[model samples]
Target: MSTLYVEQPWTSMSLLFRPHYRVEVFDEHDTPLMVVRESSGPGLQRPLRHTGFSGWTSFDLDVVAPHGQPIMHIAKQFGRRPHVRVSTPAGQLIGTIKTHGAWKQSLHDPSGQQLCFFTDIGRIDTGARAKRHGKRVRRDRVQINPQVTEPLRSLATACAVAFDVVRGTGTRHTSSGGVDWPV
Candidate 1:
């Protein structure tokens, strides 16, 4: 997976309001896929996002089809582990993304069993991708347990999108000085 959007410089709209995220998803060859758009009714619209460390920064993102049909729901709950839960639009359990620290993240079953591991750059556990393609590319890709299939793939896709959102984490620079939610 690849992230198709980042911050654009000096847009008038961004100058006036809190920046809204519209994260596009793409394939390895750069083909457009689905989109992970930030919530329309973003909770309270704050300056910080819940990065799993601290603060009340929470977010709801919808992975949608090109025609805008809901695919899956990705949400970040309050925690110190940088977890983003993935579920069906109807709220069926899919999985959770749990970060152990700055260097590693793991995909877990709803029952809390580890499925696979991914580093900040790419897969790291046993069957890790042999080599990384690019920085943003690695950030956009998360190794899914091959055992996972079907609509559940949407959950993995959402996981990749979550990594994209938090790619640079506290390091991204925006005109408005916001970290994760860049304009």
Candidate 2:
């Protein structure tokens, strides 16, 4: 029964600069375990700059060990909702992470059994409300099934962090006071 804590830094005023988002994974005692960093690959700057015009964009990130060895890769699919693929360093598919609705996201094995679930505990607004409130009102909580094994657990953790990144939970700054987004 190992537990992992994932943390993403708060970035203010992200529109001006393309920030390299780094997500840190920690152990139960708060010791650092791994670091996942966003990759600034070619053609990424265009979509980031013209966000409104860009219909869909893909991103690739690297998961690195504490000693700086690359262990896994995360690739996001282009779409309105979050969809990510976890792969080995050699590019073999491990599993997938997908957003089912506003509050629920799931990690599934290649065979399609859900290994973990992520639920957002706050209000989810659409249309004008979402534009006005952004992602500030939501808090994400991840639950991994105890039956999952070691390697899959690690992959699930990485997928959850990647989902957070794609969902803008890490980049959006929450305000002290605001109405929750409409359901």
Give a tens-digit lDDT track for model 1, residues 1-183. Answer: 322322122233333343454555554565656777766644553444322222224557788876788888887754344677888889887887776654556767788787765542234221111212421212234354455564445544665565533332321224224533212
What range of 10 consecutive residues in model 1 has the weakest lDDT sum? Answer: 124-133
lDDT of 1: 0.50
Candidate whose TM-score is highest:
2
* Most lDDT-accurate candidate: 2
For each candidate in turn, the TM-score is 0.60, 0.64
The deviation in Å at residue 154 for candidate 1 is 3.8
RMSD of each: 7.8, 7.9
| Candidate 1 clashes between residue pairs 3 or more apart in a chain or in different chains | 50-57, 52-80
Model 1 regions lying over 4 Å from their true place: 1-19, 28-30, 49-56, 119-152, 164-183
**Candidate 2 per-residue C-alpha lDDT over 17-63 given as tens digits, one digit per residue, 9 for 90 to 100:** 33354566666576777778866642654544334322235667899
